[model samples]
Target: TQLLEQSPQFLSIQEGENLTVYCNSSSVFSSLQWYRQEPGEGPVLLVTVVTGGEVKKLKRLTFQFGDARKDSSLHITAAQPGDTGLYLCAGIGNTGTASKLTFGTGTRLQVTL
Candidate 1:
């Protein structure tokens, strides 16, 4: 079983600011996904990195998978209040019959104007 940990459990920033959130694990993952959850709603998929050293950009957000496949990072440039939410990183592992998803502790981001 792999345990994922996210840094800066809480983050408060102003509009147009930049920030980076990290997800780390001791075990390797076949793939990883990042999600953003708003209050009173389920998380929405943001991006997925399958290959090691892969980087995907969604608008102002950039997602990077570590070369070792054991870590990932989410960088947001010019953050806006719309970006405020609970950010989660989930590691996907295939267990033959099924796929297991292990989610990180989570980082709550609050972007103010």
Candidate 2:
């Protein structure tokens, strides 16, 4: 079975702090997605990396797809209080298995002033 697990369920930091969130799995992912959600809204897509060993940078955040397509990582540099949110990772479900994806438990990031 394919499952994605995330580490550091909670993170509290001061402004300008840097952190890295990890996602691991035993099964390969056709595509991996990273999402962030605010207090009362749905998750917003941050980035989606499909190629193994690929990396994408969005201003202060960096996303990497594992060489094996079984893992991924998100690194934030100079984090701000506005960065506070719930981070999520998801992978496409296998056809005829489960139509929906298995997501990480989630990482609650709290950036304070």
Candidate 3:
């Protein structure tokens, strides 16, 4: 079993600021997914990175996959109060006929104006 860990369990920033969150694991993952969860709601998918060293951008947010597929990072530029939420990274691995998802400890972000 692979365990994914995220740094800075809590983050508080002002509006229009920039921040980066990290996710790391010792085992390699076939694919990695990032999600954001707001209060009283389930997490929403942000992005998925399948290729090593690949980077994907979503509006003001950027997602990067490590070259070894063992780590990933999410960067939010000009963060808004609406961006406040719980960020989670999930590692997906295929086990024969089934796929297993291991989620990180999670990072809670609060953006205040």
Clashing pairs in 2: none
Cα-based lDDT at residue 86, candidate 1: 99
lDDT of 3 by residue, 1-113 (tens): 79999988999999999999999999999999999999899989999999999999999999999999999999999999999999999999755556667999999999999
Which one wins by lDDT: 1 or 2?
1
TM-scores of all predicted structures: 0.97, 0.93, 0.96
Task: Output the worst ten-in-a-row residue range by lDDT, candidate 1.
Answer: 92-101
Error of 1 at 11 (Å): 0.3
Q: lDDT of each structure?
A: 0.95, 0.91, 0.95
lDDT, candidate 2, at 13: 95
* Predicted structure 3: lDDT: 0.95
Prediction 3 TM-score vs. true: 0.96
Model 1 agreement with the true structure over 2-54: per-residue lDDT tens digits: 89999989999999999999999999999999999998999899998999999
Q: Which window of 10 residues has the lowest lDDT sum in candidate 2? A: 92-101
